[model samples]
Target: MTKTITAVGFNFDEKQSEMIEKKLQRVSYAEEHIIDLIVRVKHEKEYSFDIVANFRWGVQANVKAEDFDFGAALNKVMDVLDQKIKKEKEKVQQH
Candidate 1:
């Protein structure tokens, strides 16, 4: 799948980018079914994470979360994303 990560209001370093990639491995089983995965992180008073997963069959799922710590927010968002992906996969299989 094609993956895109964008960060606003902060200098997103290589380490952080790598961390995201590593975290995304949680959903690697559904990679072939995913068309694109977009992640946007905004930092104001706190960190906000917005993730969109576009499936090959034209389905889309979005998950969002916010936290004072970057890692915490990322973890929260990714956990939600993992669940969404699993649900979508089940739907596709049933059809």
Candidate 2:
């Protein structure tokens, strides 16, 4: 799979980028396909985290969360993505 994790709308340090990449990679278990992930962290009054996973199958999933802690927001977003992927996997399997 062509996997890429990118951060937009905010600056991410190397360590934070690596952490997000690793976490996302662990959640990605799809077969041969092009997968592009966009991770956006927006900080205004509160921090907003948005993750978008796009696949060649035309399956697109987005997770969003807001939190004071960046790591916590990332974790929440990842969990939401994990659940969405699992649901999609089941749907594909059933078809």
Candidate 3:
């Protein structure tokens, strides 16, 4: 699985990009089932981070969050995605 991150209204330095990759990698359940991670960041009034986690077997999770800080927004969105990923993992285990 791979993560694709695109940012608008800001340029992501290598360090910042690596930080995002690291954060996404921290999700264990998402690592196993997720096939593609599409991250779109928009910097309007506030920093908006949108994440699309595309998992295997046609399952997917989408989360959007906004904050003055990019890291905060990213963390928020990732938290929601983690919950969704965990639920999907449990669903598979039950079957």
The candidate maximizing TM-score is: 1
Compared with the true structure, all predictions reach lDDT values of 0.93, 0.74, 0.83
Candidate 2 residues 3-70, lDDT tens each?
54545566788888777777877675754433677777787666688877776678888889988887
Instruction: State the lDDT at 66 in candidate 3.
Output: 89
RMSD of 3: 1.5
Q: Residue 27 in candidate 1 has what lDDT?
A: 85
Q: Which prediction has more favorable TM-score, 1 or 3?
A: 1
lDDT of 3 by residue, 17-85 (tens): 887888887685457688988899898788898888887878778888889987888889888878888
Q: TM-score for each prediction?
A: 0.95, 0.79, 0.87
Alpha carbon lDDT at 56, candidate 1: 93
Model 3, stretches more than 4 Å misplaced? none
Worst 10 residues of 1 by lDDT: 10-19
Q: Summarize candidate 1's per-residue lDDT along 1-95 as a digit string, tens digits.
A: 99999999897888888889899988889899999999999999999999999999999999999999888999999999999998998998999
Please report the candidate that would top lDDT against the real structure.
Answer: 1
RMSD of each: 0.9, 2.3, 1.5
In model 1, the runs with Cα more than 4 Å from the true position are none
